[model samples]
Target: MIIGIVKEIKSSEYRVAATPGAVTELVRNGHEVIVEHDAGTGSGFTDEMYEAAGAIVADEAERVWTSVDMIYKVKEIFPEEFKYLREGLIIFTYIHSNAHLDQTKALMESKCISIAYEDISDDKGQWPLLSPMSELAGKGGFLAALHFSQTINGGTGKLLANVCGVETPVITIIGCGNAGLGACELAAAFGNRVNVLDINHDAMMDAKKRLPQNVTFMFSNRENLVECMKTSDVIINCVLWPKTRKDHLIYREDLKLMKKGAMIIDVACDEGGAIETCRSTTHTDPIYFVDGVMHYCVDNIPSAFAQTASATLSNATLPFALAIANKGVKQALKDDKHLRRGLTTFDGKLTLLETAKKLNLPYTSADEIVSTF
Candidate 1:
């Protein structure tokens, strides 16, 4: 099959869909790869490197889109590229349709076989593909939040880590999942006084047992959450609802209770987010203030370091990509139940029930869809 890798056009989105090592493997598997010019430059992989691996470089996205049987991407499609979409091409990427209604509509209208990496599961019912990125975003949340907490940036003017005899920063991580745990780990490493909250008592207990010395675990309830937010210096929103719209844990009104200049970095912003104040921002202009509270909601947080992001992401996706390419999506799903769970939208139908219910759209059972495939 002819596969295409397009350069990301989103703000500061430097991660390419394919790398030279990935291209080399595709060639060995007898697949041709067409890369948009300089797609890997930001990722520190030059065109020559891809050529050495037997991939062709196309000058424009239009050429790659028209020629490839499947398109591999790191992010969702933009409105400008919506016109290039064809009826039957396969799109393998983080469709993120739940957070993006317009893109969801476009993909359905295009009638393409689209799969979202975020929705894919492993045998253990974990999102392996989304994990690596989650790790990156989890760690990044602390760094971004710290910067956002400075008074110059409209933050609460508190340092994440304090010197001896000084009060340590009060940091609250509003989730105990991968992203939340990730932030907690980093925040603790920096010597911040951190509190980790989760709805699951077992999870909270587990976190308390395993968390670093600087971290604390607490049960998440409206009262506990409100009090934590009011006193915390930095808040990391790292909660997710998977393929559905995220339930709001923090309303805009809640911002009034936060200390002046308190920072809130919603790491799960791409998945719609736990905080009501969160909206997608870009790396170029990543922070904004709402009622004297700072928010960092960059959708593609991993894009800031393209090379590492590409290598880590490609590792998780390559096997799945090859599976779909070799066995085809239909046969592949039959052979691997885990991959079958990854089916979000297939040939214009919303096979993921949660997405359909959330959007109030027509739906099909994934099991039924896989059978037809």
Candidate 2:
């Protein structure tokens, strides 16, 4: 199989989907690897590194996209790349089909075999591909809060960490999943009062066992959430909102309950999903003021720490990518139930039920489609 690794073109997105080590592994497996020139430069990888790993370096992204059997990317396909979609090319990436309606249409119309890394699950029901990036995003989100809370950034001048002769600022984190735990670990380590809220008792208990005394576990509910908003200096939302759900966890009216200058770092930057006011921001303009409260909702927070994020993400996705490369797309999907779960589109059909329901389009099961082929 010929696999192509293209440089990320999204604004301020620096993480490349593939690394030199990852390419080396692919080459070792007898798979031809093509990398766009400077694809890994943003992540501190030079073109010579990829060449040393036995990857063919293409001068233009078009050569990598047009000549490869499969495209490995970090983000969803953009409008410019939509023209590259063909009948049989496989796209293995974080194709958030529910969020991008036009991309979904492009995949279906082009009959591409597309797999969404975010939707892939392990036996324990955890998103393996999405977990590494989510963890980084969570930690980065807290860092963003710390930076934005400084007086220079138009914040309240209260540091997130405990200071001598100064009161410790409170930080409330919603959801105790991978992202929330990441945020909690950082926030609590800084000697701040960290409150982690989750409706799942088992999850909260699990977090409590790992976290220090500075962190408090709270049940997520309207009353508790409201109280956190009123008292906490920073609120970090880590909940992965459902694509089909119209309701928001934090409504527009809830902003008034928060302290003035308190910022919200939405690790789960689902537009109009978890937070009513959250629209995907870029690293260029990461913050916006809404009702006197600051919002840090960069869609790709992990991109800010490209080198670490790329390596971790590459490690997570490599096994699955190798599976597809070795066994072919259809055979791999048919063999691995977890991999099949990640299928967004197969042979021009909409295989992701969530995207279909969100868009009110017709749905086809990946299993059903793969079986026929």
Candidate 3:
């Protein structure tokens, strides 16, 4: 099977879907890899590296997209690439179909087999493909707060770290998942007082065992949330909001409860999902003031650390990609229920129930579709 790796074209997106090492693995597995020219440049892998790994270097993205049996990518398909969608083409990527209605429509209309990396789960019920990037996003989110908190960056001018002969800064993190733990690790290491809130007692206890003394675990209730807003210098939200939920955890009106010059770093970045005021931003313009409180909600925080992000993400996703390539999409889906869970569209039908319900489209179960084959 031919696997295509295309350069990410999203704004400020520097991470490539595959690295030279990943291409080498594909080549070793007896699969042909077509990498677009400079596809790995942003991630510090040159075309010569890909060639050294036995991948064919295509001068144009069109060539790679057209020639490959499957397109392996990092971001969702943009409108410009919508024209490339065709029958039986397999798109294996982070296809957030629920978030992008038009992209879902295009994938269904084109009769492509679209698998979402974010929706794929392991036996432990964790999103294996999404976890690596989520951790990076969490750490990067805190770093963004540290940078934007400086007065020079139009922030409150208060340093995020603890200082001698001064009160320690407070960092509040919502959720105790991979992203939250990543943010908490960094925030606590900086000697700042960190508060992690979640409704899951088990998760909080686990986080407590791993975190330092300065970190506090609290139940994620309205009272605790309000208290955190008022006291925290930086609030990092790591919760993944459901697509069907219309209500927000932090409402726009609640911004007034925050301290003046305080900032929110939304690692989740679900527009109108978790935080009412959060709209996806780019690295070029990552922050804005809402009710005098700063908001840093860059949708792709991990992209800023392209090299590390690419390496971790590639390692986590390569095994699954190889499975599909080796066994073909149908057999792979039939064999692995976890992989089938990620199927968004198959043969022009919507296989992901969440996306169908959110978009008011027809729904087809993965079992039903796979059984037919």
Candidate 4:
């Protein structure tokens, strides 16, 4: 099987889907790896490195896309890439079908096998492919707050860290998942008072054991949320909002409850999902003001740390990619039930229930499609 690696073309997206080490692994397995020229440049891997790993270096993305059996990527397929979609082509990537209706349509119309990394579940019910990037996004979200909080960056000029002879800053984190824990770890390490709120008692208790004494765990109720808004210097939201839910956790009017100059860092930048005011932003123009409250909702926060993000993401996704390559998409989906959960589209049918319900499209179960194979 031939695996293609293409450079990410999304705005401010520097992370590559595969590193030379990952290519080496594919080559070692007797699979032909085709890497587009400069595909890994943003992640600090040169073309020579890919060549050293026994991958064919194509001068153009078209060559890699056309020649490979499967296209391994980091971001969703853009409109420009939509023309490349064809029957039986396998796209293994972070295909957020529920968010991008047009891309989902293209995938279905093209009859391609599209697997979403974000939807893939492990035996523990955790998103293994999405976890690495989520952790990085959480840590990077806090760093963004630290940078934007400075007066020079047009922020409130309030320092996010604790200072001598001054009151300590408060950082409020919503949810106790991987992203929230990552943000809490950084916030508490800076000696700032950190409050982690979640409805899950088990999750909160687990977070409490790992976090510092300065960190407080609270129930995620309306009262606690309002209180956090009024007191916290920074609020980091890590909840993954459902695509079908129309209501928001933080409404547009709720921004008024926050302190003046306070900022919100939404690690899960689901537009109109969790936060009513959140619209996806790019790193080039990451922040905006809504009712005088600053919002930092860059959709791809991990892209800011391309090298680390690429390495970690590649490590998590390589095994699954290898499985599909070696066993073929049908056999692999049939064998691994967890991997089948990621199947968004197969043979021109929408196989993901969430995406079908969100987009009002026809639904086909992955199990049903795999059984037919």
Candidate 5:
């Protein structure tokens, strides 16, 4: 099979779909890897690196897009690249279809086999492709919030960590998942008064036992959340429900309840922001004010540290790419149920129930889709 590694064109997207080492692995396994020129530059990788790894560098995206049976990418195809889609050309990437109606419509209309990385679940019920980036975003979210918490940045001027005579800022987290856990880790590391709230009793219990005494764990509810928000210097929003629009837990009026000049980090911006005031921002201009509260919601936080993010993301996805390349999607998915869950769309039909319901499209049962394979 011929694989195409296309350059990512999303705004501020810096990670590449495949690194040179990844290309070498595919080449050694009797697969032909065609990478677009300068595809890996954002990750500090060059064309020479790919050439040395036995990959053919194509000057044109058209050449890469049309010639390959499947096109692998870091981010989903942006509007500029949408014209390259052809029927049966498989797209494997982080397609946050629930949030972007236009992209979802394009994928469905194109009749391509669209495999979303976020929908693919492991036996432990975790997202494989989306995890690395989420970890990066979670850590970045804290820094973004910290920036906004400074007086010059329109914040209340409360330091996350206290001095000898000063009080520490309170960091309130709304979820206990990967992003939430990451925020908690950073906030606690910075010596802030951290409060992690989650609806999952098990997660909250685990957090209570694992974290330091300064890090508080609480059950998530309207009363608790409202009180926490009222006093919080920084609030990190990580709540998410995969394959559906995010529930805006913080309403427009909720920002008023928060302390003036408080900062918010909505890590779920790509899914949908957790805060009503949260709108997607870029690294170049990443903060805004709403009702005296500062919001930092950059959808692609990993882009800020491309080199580290690229390697980590590529390493996590390499095994799955190899599996599908060597065994083909049908056989590989049949053998591994985790890979099977990755199939968002196949054979001109939407196969994921949540995605179909969110998109208002007809649903194809997972069992039925797997049976076809």
Candidate 6:
């Protein structure tokens, strides 16, 4: 199998899908790895590193995109790359199909096979590919709050950390998942009063065991959330909103309930999904004001920490990529039920139920699609 590693073209996206070591692994497994020039530069891996790892370095992205059986990338396919879509090409990346209707259409019309990293599940029903990035995003979201809280950055002028003579800042984190726990860990370390809310009692209890005394676990509900909104200096949303759900966890009007100059860091930057005010900001313009409340909802927060993010993300997705490369996409998906969950599109059909329901498109089960092929 010929695999291509293309540089991420998304705005402010710095992480690469594969690292030099990952390329070496592929090369050792008898798979040809092609990397576009400077593909790993943003992640601190030079072109020479890839070349030394036995990867063919292509001068042009088109060459990499056109020559490969599978294109490995960090982000979803953007408009500029849409023209490169071809039948039988495997797009292995974080295809947020439900969020990008145009991209979904492009993939279906092109009849390419796309496996979404974010949708793939593990044996324990955890998103293995998405977890590493989610953890980074969680920490990055908290770091963003700390920076945005300074008065110089159009913030409320409240310090996130505890001061000698001042009161500790209160941070409210929604959900106790990987992202939320990551946020809570950092926020509590800063000596802030951290409140983690989740609907699952087991999850909350599990988090309570690891967190510090300053962190409190609360049951997520309208009343508790509203109370937290009124008192918390920062609110971090880590809930993975369902794509087909029409309702939002935090409504536009709910922003008014927050204190003036308070901010929201949405780790799960689902546009109109979790927070009504969130509309996927970029690293260039990461913050916006809505009803006196500031919002930081960069969809690719892990990109800010390129080197660490690239290595961790590469490690998480490499095993699955190896499986597909070794056994072929069909046999790999057939053998690993968890990997089949990542199948967003196969042979021009939308195999992801959430995306189909969200976009009003016809749905085909991945199992059914693979059986027919």
Mind giving the per-residue lDDT tens digits that candidate 1 earns over 1-373?
Answer: 8999999888899998778998899989999899999999999999999999999999998999999888999898899988877777888888777667788888888888788888899877679999998888988888888777677875666778866888888899988888888888889988998988888887777777777778877778899899998898888887774455446789888899888667788898843446877778889998887887778888888888689999999999999888877777678778887777767677788877777777888988778976765
Error of 1 at 35 (Å): 1.2
As a TM-score, model 1 comes out at 0.94
Kindly give the number of clashing pairs for every candidate: 2, 0, 0, 0, 0, 0
All predictions: root-mean-square deviation over Cα?
Answer: 2.0, 0.8, 0.7, 0.7, 2.0, 0.8
Better of 5 and 6 by lDDT: 6
The window of 10 residues in a row where model 2 has the poorest summed lDDT is 364-373
Q: Please give, for residues 1-373, the per-residue lDDT of candidate 2 as tens digits.
A: 9999999889999999988999999999999999999999999999999999999999999999999999999999999999999999999999999989899999999999999999999999899999999899999999999998999987888999989898899999999998999999999999999999998999999889999999988899999999999999999999988888899889999999998878899999999888999988999999998888899999999999999999999999999999999999989999999999999998889999999998888999988887886
Error of 5 at 142 (Å): 0.3
Candidate 3 local lDDT, 128-227, one digit each (tens):
9999999999999999999999989888789888899998999999988999999999999999999999999999999899999999999999999999
Q: lDDT tens string, model 4, 7-84?
A: 889999999988899999999999999999999999899999999999999999999999999999999999999999
Q: To one decimal, what is the Cα RMSD in angstroms of model 1 from the true structure?
A: 2.0
**In model 3, which runs have C-alpha deviations exceeding 4 angstroms?**
none
lDDT of 5 by residue, 123-197 (tens): 788887888888788888988887777888776677778567887789999898878887788889889999998
Ten residues in sequence with the least summed lDDT for candidate 6: 240-249
TM-score of 6: 0.99
- Tell me the spans in candidate 1 whose CA falls farther than 4 Å from its real position: 205-210, 242-247, 270-273
Among all windows of ten consecutive residues in candidate 1, which has the lowest summed lDDT?
239-248
The ten-residue window of minimal lDDT in model 5 covers 269-278
TM-score of 3: 0.99
Clashes (candidate 3): 0
> What are the Cα lDDT values of the candidates?
0.83, 0.94, 0.94, 0.93, 0.82, 0.93
